[model samples]
Target: MRWSAAALAAGQILVGGPVAAAPTVVIIALLAVVGLGVAVADRRLNTAVAWRQVSAVLMAVDLLATLGLVLAGLLQGNDELWVLLVLVVLAAALRYRIRGALAVALGAGLANGLLELLVNGGEPGPVIVGRLLVLLVVGGFAGSIARELDVERRLYQRMAEASQDIVAKRDEDAILGALARHVKDALDGSRATVHRYTLAGWEEVQLPDVLSVGSADGGPPLLTDEEGGVSATLHRLTWQQGSGRQPNRLTLPIRLPERPAEYVVAVEVTGPRPSALAEGALLALAESSAVSLATRDLIRHQEASNRRLERLEALRTRFVATVAHDLRSPLTTVKGVARILRGRREQVAPEQVDAMLASVERQANRLNRLADDLLDAARLDSDALELKLTDVAIDDILRSVVDDAGDEVELLGTPGLVVEADGPRLERVVWNLVTNALKYGRPPVHLCAETDGDQLTISVRDHGRGLGPEQVENLFQDFAGSGDPDSVGLGLAIVWELVEAHGGRVEYRPADPGADFVISIPRERTPGGSDR
Candidate 1:
């Protein structure tokens, strides 16, 4: 009912005589009438059909209103009436469907030309016709351009929606498959496949293939010939009528670090040539996918490493338990024999007693050293070695180690050398080095100490056969030895561990005739000390 009233009002005003009312009032009346009709019709029609019909009717109404106003002004001898016609035409072209609106504009233009002839009392001239033609052309062109813009906008919206769907999928295979399908649709390709290359080779995956299979067989060549290079190549191929072969093919290589060539992707397509924009977008997608594949591979490798480390830890626990159990029996026997020998020392025969006591002492010392090394290694592995730090003279510690070993070490120029260290551990380090020199060095082992600024240096020189470069490289490594049948190979390893704990470093150099092992530690300030 309201629409009927509005339409009647608009029709009455359009047919009414000329007056001084504003031109805008006429435009608003026409728009209200057209908009009301459209709203009513839309309730009974499908949305697309309703929009088209309403747009057509509104454009016609706008054209008739423009003609009526133009005719009224011409009849009244108004010269500025063409401006009203232009506004109506532009508004109609902008607001309505292109095809029907352009048709209405043509009809209105013809009516206006005829009205002009009638008002001027003759047929219209070429000047009037040309003016009408220009208006029609401008309006039609604007409408067509707007329609084309609308079509492009809709297409972009659809592509965006499809891309969003692909990105939201959790499964990689599904995502890749969707991406390939989107590419095929966008490029109008007959078929599209994504191939990944790894160190082993390349593999073809279905649109959604996510199982990570490798391509080792003579599959089609990679897009780029250069090793580890990523690029895209397009080729045109012959296709038989019913052979289901694609006529145009495109291959793209996806590269990521530390991944096999098979994991990289080569997108294959067969159809008409793809545009540069389409190809660029496809390459971008492939590169992103390659990064994701590389990330997944790294995660897998780290998980494997963690599992291996757990297994190694278990084995180490078992080995330590076994070693501890084996050493207990020997320790018990040595302790028992030592006690017996000590209690009957006066009553025992000299030769028999001497031999028995020597055997007991040797075995006891061996057991003690083995136990100490095992504990120390365990502490190091667990990162549980704590240091009791103190300032001690390096020369004093060396002298004490030599005294404990009961070996004569030839002293070179003595230097007052003090170092910040744990006394017991430092003593152990010096003793191990001196003992190693005594055991392996030719007679007359040399012990020397010197200090320079913040560093204290100590060296044990031996005249034994020198170690080779390879042996020296691994000399301080645990369980590494001089290849001697009688040596257990733990002395230098222990020396290294203890010296490192005291913030010192050790090096072995082949002396002129034998070997020289040197240790350097940070020197501490000595209080009330004289050169010794």
Candidate 2:
């Protein structure tokens, strides 16, 4: 429009004659120069504020320049300069829609006709009337086309923005949130919400008002279908609340392949409802959002898989190093003790020989425990460790595991406390706890248990330095634990897996003097295989 307006004026200037007023020619040339300069200088005018300002300025310039040329009598023999008025009208329409264009058209036509008549000494001729009619008609037609084009432009721009937002979000919640915000803005609504139908109820992006599904108000439900499978539909809602606002609703059901109409986007506004262009945009947004959300899910799943693989690789490397060091230390001790015993049987006294043998036995026991933990871990990894779900006394498991820790370990719990579990697996869980307490803890390690309703609570507490916050956090992770010399790091991991298999959880309970490891197993749940 800017170039066209400038070209029409330049054509008048080039058709040289006295009728082509030199001042008029200079003004048109100046308008073109200024238009070209603005176009070149304001390259970053992508925002609404900048574009609107530029359009207003250009429209004003075109109208004033056209009037100046007509007043100067430069266009007396030619009405070609009138084409510049059409461009001015179109520019007004682009800036402020059809009303703006019609305004410019009427104002320019009357101003030009009045000026021409005054210049020609009050002649009400056919030429002036015809020009006014041409101006009004051209302005009205151009305004209509501009309005339609503007609507289509806005729709495309909004859709593209929504699509970009969807693709940029990395998670489902973010995608849904982005979709809701963009949908609301696109539809020019007060509130917009995305709802996903679930078995429990309808879950929405924004917490719905009291009018959500299943409320006692018994107002019109959000979902039209009784089975919660409605397709795309729009409805008008009457609210009992609000002071002066009349709220309307636009519901669009987004259906994915092989899925029912489970996800819906609802937009509510106070004033006017969305136009057909906005409705079309909403539908396109829904369809594109579904595909983009699915693609986002696939991307997230792949990222999670990659993270798991990286973790497994790290665990394998750490496990190999830790197992080798634990096993080698114990075996080397046993070997050194045996060599000493073989060489000094005659020189050593019976008491001294017995002490040496006990040292060898302790190292051998350490090696055996390491081997057992490794085997249990491998069984857990292979999903081959089945549980023997039977009625077992929880108190018995606690006392037995504590007693196996020797005299220093104390048992404190209720009697005849029973639960349904794999006795051996439950015993290994207790055994690992006791082993951990004995190895890293002070004397008087306490094992306690209690049955409360349907849950069995067992705790093995250590009165030593216990563990730091960091150690406590990773206490139950593979190859991760407190930096105790005797810890192979698999004891608590195995204990956690076994307890979880029995439908229980183990946690590091904060104790005043030390740290407490508590395992809570539900007695009502049937035992299952371990998960490490």
Query: Which candidate comes out best when scored by TM-score?
Result: 2
Reference-based TM-score of each model: 0.41, 0.57
lDDT of 2 at 383: 83
Could you give me the TM-score of model 2 versus the true structure?
0.57
* Residue-wise C-alpha lDDT for candidate 1, range 305-330, written one tens digit per residue: 99878856755665556456547756
- The per-model lDDT (C-alpha) reads 0.61, 0.70
In the range 188-243, model 2's lDDT, one tens digit per residue, is 65666667777886665454441243334434344433445533332222122223
Worst 10 residues of 1 by lDDT: 233-242
Worst 10 residues of 2 by lDDT: 234-243
